[model samples]
Target chain A: MTSFFIYKAILVVVVFGIMLMAAMYSTYLERKVAAFIQDRVGPNRAGPFGILQPLADGIKMFMKEEIIPEVANKTLFIVGPCIAMLTAIMAGVVIPWGGELVINGVPYVLQIIDFDFGLLYVFGVVSLGVYGIMIGGWASNNKFSLFGAIRASAQMISYEIAMGLSIIALIMMTGTLSLREIVEFQAGGTGSTWNFWNVVYQPLGFLLFLVCAFAECNRTPFDLPESETELVGGYHTEYSSMKLGFYLFAEYINMFISSAVISTLYFGGTNFPFMNDLGLSQNAITILGTLAFFIKIGFFVFFYMWIRWTLPRFRYDQLMYLGWRVLIPLAIANVAITGLVMILTDRI
Target chain B: MKSLTGRAKVLDNPKMTFKERIYLPAIIGGITITLRHLFKRKATIRYPEEKRTFSPVWRGMHVLKRDDNGAERCTACGLCAVACPAEAITMTAAERKPGEEKLYREEKYAATYEINMLRCIFCGLCEEACPKEAIFLTDRLVSTDYARDGFIYGKDKLVEPVDKRVDVSKRQTPNVLEFKKIKHYRHNR
Candidate 1:
């Protein structure tokens, strides 16, 4: 038990470090992607290929002035970005990074926590993600920030419904709320029964979930809250120094979490097909699974950046319309169709 | 009426069809175009380490000329100052002493010359006005400076270095060279 506790502690630290590093580098990747899309060379001076740009940026963010509004609610203003970063880091706990690792004849799960209701736990924490934005925006005493806060809250709420519906369909098919079991259920046989990868079973659900994920992360097209033309810097408009850094970091971490969730729920998480045939050792397979998982996460991150540069922001009306009218209805129809198909096939 | 060039068409803002209204296909098309551009050659020159070739006749920073024998070409005739639309050029003429024949080609030479770059329009009118082939615009831009007074380029900034040559021959076209030759011939006559 003591050894297991030690393992868990190490895993927690590792996951936290990975989350922070990934968030930091996401900013660099965002700039590079934007530059590429526009046919310009981005930030290549700091280090080789500008890989150290994020480190430079972090240092710069740290060195900046931390200004709080004189008339603002100082306590909430201070707590806002702290809450944002905290919530952003908290969502990765239940995500299974790999299958298992056996060290000295003791098997250890690669995930930090594997609660039975892992899906609900992630959703619960993510829903609280809005409080950070709201508090920051409201406390700023700026009308633009307040408007952004309101929009953000409304957007998150509207999209959460469709997102929940989409996940509900997946839950019905998998019959478990645990993310680990969902991955296990999707792990198909070597011969070609590679039957899982929930995307095959729930293509429409995946699409709806993906669109909802974009909104949930407050990414482009759905990024009306932070629309520079409208709200300046939006929720973090008055935030500066590391406080502002925390808000931006929280956003990237949120993107990372959403990508992880999507890949786990639909793309088979860390389960690589035909691994048994390769005859790799158990520990080797675990390592390979983690690598495969990162590759999937990387692709999704790229997709986020790709679509961001590709698409323009939607009008506020269009955003609400899509969330309520388009995504919700599609998610419902997907759930119905999935239920009907499962019933007809007697797989329920 | 039809366009003389067969390219022009009537402009119309037609209603979007169902497929177009969805916008997915158009978005995908835009993404494809942008993706294609991702691999295309970038148009920027990156300034310091790399430079784009300037056009042969490109007018940039001013350069007071020197003949191949390294004698100053300006005769302090003030034609360039007179032709300057901005009136940015100012010069003080001094008679060339007998011993200074190797230094100054003409009997009269500009003792103190200055061109306020902030006021100059960079239209190459001064180059066109110079009868002595003394002034030409070279393919070097005036660098940025903090003080407004820094923009006032004196003879030290404008003149060609003695040991190292500054080439502005490309800017003197055949017509201009012939015109200079004729002007010199008329001056001698």
Candidate 2:
């Protein structure tokens, strides 16, 4: 029992380390991406291609000053980014990185805890993500920040419905909410023949899921809360130094989580084709599969950075309109169509 | 920017109707557009190793000419210094002695010619005003650096080597009198 606990602890630590590194690098990458799209040289002096820029940025943030608004909620002001960071990291816990690892003859799945309701658990965790922004904006004691918070909350809630509904269609098709089962199903076939992959069979679901995923994560076009010209700094208007860093770091963490979920649902999670047929050992296959999954995930993450740099943000009313009128209806119709098709095909 | 709330809400309103509110059709349409651009030949040029071609007439950085015999062309006539609207050009006059005839073309020559590049508007008036045809804006890329002081162009910094012109005739000297006469001829006619 103790050893099981220890194993879980180790998994948590490793995932935490990945999230931390990815978050730090993501910020540096965002700047580099922006520069690249505009045909300008970004930070290259700090390190090779400005690799050490994250460290420099961290140091700068830490050394700088912190302030509290006189009329603002002091506890919540500090709590805002903390909650944002906490909730962001918390979303990663249920996500499985590798399939399984047997250390000293003790076999275990390389996840912190594989909850039965894994899909819902992710949705639940992400839903709470809004609280961080809401609290931060409210605590800011600025009317602009409050307005941003309201818009953000409304956007998130509306997108969450579409996101949740899209997953229902996937869940119905798969017949299980468990992420591990989804991976196991995909493992048996060769690359393109893998019917287990969600992107192939449920392409409309994947499309709706991808769009909702962007909105849920508060990415560009949907990034109205912190719109520089409009809300100033948005929820973190009054935040500075490490506090601000926490908020930015949380955003990357949210991105990593969302990317992982997308991979798990539509791209077959950590599963690759006919690994046992390839004659690789179980451990080797598991490691290979894990690596393959991350490669796909990394591409999606890069895609986000690329898209973020290339696109312009949306207006507030436009954003809300897109979320409610557009995404929700399509997601519902998609769910209905998939359900009807599955019943007719007897794949259900 | 908050568009002026009262007026902008009405004038610039892309009002969402029944179908417009449903974002998927619009998003799909938009994604189709972006995907085309993504696959299309990108207009972006990876700088440093690969550079975009500049025009032959592109007046980038300035250079002070030396004669075919390697003589300083300026007489420190202060015509360029006086005509510069930006007051970027500065020079001090020095007299050439009998022994240093090879060094300078005229009796009075520029002792120190410096341009505060930060102040230079690059209006080409200095090129217009030079009687000796010494200063010319050529197509040259400048090295970018951090400091504000690095931007200032000294006499040494602005000077380019009198190399064999690949495009222009190698034997031709930049004749200030000839150029001035051409300008005078144009003006007179």
Report the lDDT tens digits of candidate 2 across residue range A260-302: 9888888878877676568876678779878988888887887
Taken over the whole model, the C-alpha lDDT of each candidate is 0.91, 0.79
| The best candidate in terms of DockQ | 1
The complex in candidate 2 yields a DockQ of: 0.12
Q: Which run of 10 residues does model 2 chain B get worst, by summed lDDT? A: B164-173
For model 2, the interface Cα RMSD in angstroms equals: 4.6
Scored against the true structure, residue B148 in model 1 reaches a CA lDDT of 99
Model 2 misplaced regions, further than 4 Å: A35-43, A185-187, A190-195, A334-348, B1-177, B180-189
TM-score of each predicted structure versus truth: 0.95, 0.77
Chain B TM-score per candidate, please: 0.83, 0.75
